[model samples]
Target chain A: MNFSSKILEDAVNEMSQLPGVGKRTALRFVLHLMRQPEQQTDQLSTALTRMRHDLKFCKKCHNVSDGDLCEICSSPKRDETIVCVVEDIRDVMAIENTSQYRGLYHVLGGKISPMDGIGPQDLKVRSLVERIKKDGVQEIIFALSPTIEGDTTNFYIFKQLEGIDIRTSTIARGIAVGDELEFADEVTLGRSIAQRVPYESSIKN
Target chain B: MNFSSKILEDAVNEMSQLPGVGKRTALRFVLHLMRQPEQQTDQLSTALTRMRHDLKFCKKCHNVSDGDLCEICSSPKRDETIVCVVEDIRDVMAIENTSQYRGLYHVLGGKISPMDGIGPQDLKVRSLVERIKKDGVQEIIFALSPTIEGDTTNFYIFKQLEGIDIRTSTIARGIAVGDELEFADEVTLGRSIAQRVPYESSIKN
Candidate 1:
């Protein structure tokens, strides 16, 4: 797409660099910004710049934070002994919304995707190990997604805690609460049956 | 969606103010920025700010431009007697891509939409009329989309040029190229049949 103005072209080019955004969508976004008041653009720019420059990560859990520790990590009410391991801060938010887990979270930042050149070293694995040792975390919940990369990251972290005396468990894989059993995928259904719990335990909650 | 950092939340909030962007997608964009190097965020913010602050519109046609006159308006090779009226710069780009029209364009910025409280006075109608009279344009072509608002805008402009000695025409509305006639909508098919051109004219370049 040809643009009459170099400034518009530059803005579109930069916007198109985002994941999943194409030239046309970027152009739409740029044109929309141009139509809005100058103050809107200024606010957007200031917010993004401030976010990039001032945002910090929790020193303990690696979750995004404005200070040295994230809200969950700093909260005294959350269980420090049971730490849930996840791939990113978004996952932390998702789990937090459920209100089912009251423990702290360890955001790994990303999964072990060898195809993407992201190895164990690229993640916060070392810090997580040191965190477990330093905090004496008793129960570690592997809340990573059910994918090959997620499994690989989980196993890598499990191996890192080999010498430690901690009980590690993964989140359950089963059909959704309201979904029909017939529509459940074969792998998940099989796993649900294989890992079936006693009826009493299942209803305990 | 909850955000761990206030800066991150502000960025997401501002980003989500864009058309079609929701809080979830905004969060994704914010998180993606956080994962990249700080330079990437800086470039994006700077480009957008520069575009908003430094961009200019063509004084004649109202299309986005780096100078007072747009490329098309400034080019001596373009036909000065023929003007294609469009809704915005995007329409100008679309028409330019065809490479068939070598005439100048007048961007109205937007169509008359009572639902949106947009009227002819809010557009560049007065400037367009003044330009036509000053330049002695011989023909006017309306290339707006086939919508109620588009038709209303075209009619409004046509009424404005009622006493002027100029020929006015609208873009031909017919079944799209490669579209099956059987699949064509009733109104379009009827219009295409009623407005059928001579066989020689249809086959002519």
Candidate 2:
């Protein structure tokens, strides 16, 4: 490959890195751009630059936000007392679209996976515990995935919330193996939230 | 759905209109945007607006160009006499990537598909004929697709150049049905260019 060809190849490589874009698809995309009016090409470049510069994580929920907090966190319409604990902001968004649960959310950043070197300390477990102890939260629902790591994270949270009178629950319905919450359809997501079960039996207490 | 939910649904609908994005994928994309750091979301909106304002086509080659002519058509290194005719600017970029051809290009805008309501005059065919006759060109290679519309377009152009002495040809080999030029591998594209086959001989004397 010559110098110019290398540049074209580099462009294709960068494009293929985006989600759902393979080599052939990347090539097709780049060719589409080349076919577009000059304005369209500029739009994509400017969009990337702007996205890198302007986006920030919400200080409260860790979701993407324009200001100090996310739109959901700031909205008065949400049930602030019922907080849904999730692994990431994508989960927050997923639940939002379902219109199933009208409550606030707490993004954990990620699950507790010690094998990948991620532990309870690495997640927002501390923040979550702090939020529960400090705020007047009535129910803390674990809306995390059904994976082993997700289960471990849920248990870890369950242990910490033991003494509190507030209800501790996990979204107990309709999550499949290795399938992400972000991909769940509205019907399934709605059903799961509606059918949440208590995390503890509290035998003979 | 409430009024706000309706707006969100429309946003998803707009995204799903793109070639590969389905409703599920569209929902994912919209939810991603709703969760976007305000900056990224704003950037996407801004980019869409800016593109509509800034992009335009080059008058000479009809490829997307910032200036009056596309970079390839304006470059001094490209051969003026050998004009490679294509269906769109995307096809132009594909041939340019081969780096084996230094010739200029003429975009036909689209193929001649009567069933789809596209005709010769509807394309850049007349302008191509004019360019060849006025510029005293030696060759015009048909780099359009191998489909029915592509064949129709090819025959239409051949008839238009009936009186001209200039040699007209196409990239000779290594492409299959439903194969897009953008997806073909580099080696295959190179071989196709090398094996140039002549069209039906003897135009009007």
Query: Which candidate leads in DockQ?
Result: 1
How well does candidate 1 reproduce the true complex, by DockQ?
0.81
Poorly placed runs, candidate 2 (over 4 Å):
A1-17, A22-80, A96-102, A115-117, A173-205, B1-18, B22-56, B74-77, B173-205
Model 1 chain B weakest lDDT span, ten residues long:
B1-10
State how far residue B136 of model 1 sits from its true place (Å). 1.1
Q: Compared with the true structure, what per-residue lDDT tens digits does model 2 show for residues A31-128?
A: 56555575555545554444445555667777666567777878989888998999976687678767889988888988999899998898888887
Off by over 4 Å in 1: A198-205, B200-205
In candidate 2, what fraction of native interface contacts survive? Answer: 0.00
Where does candidate 2 clash, by residue pair? A39-B55
- Give the alpha-carbon lDDT of every model: 0.92, 0.71
Which predicted model would earn the best TM-score? 1
In candidate 2, residue B192 scores what lDDT? 69
Chain A of candidate 1 compared with the true chain A, TM-score? 0.92
> Candidate 1: which docking quality band?
high
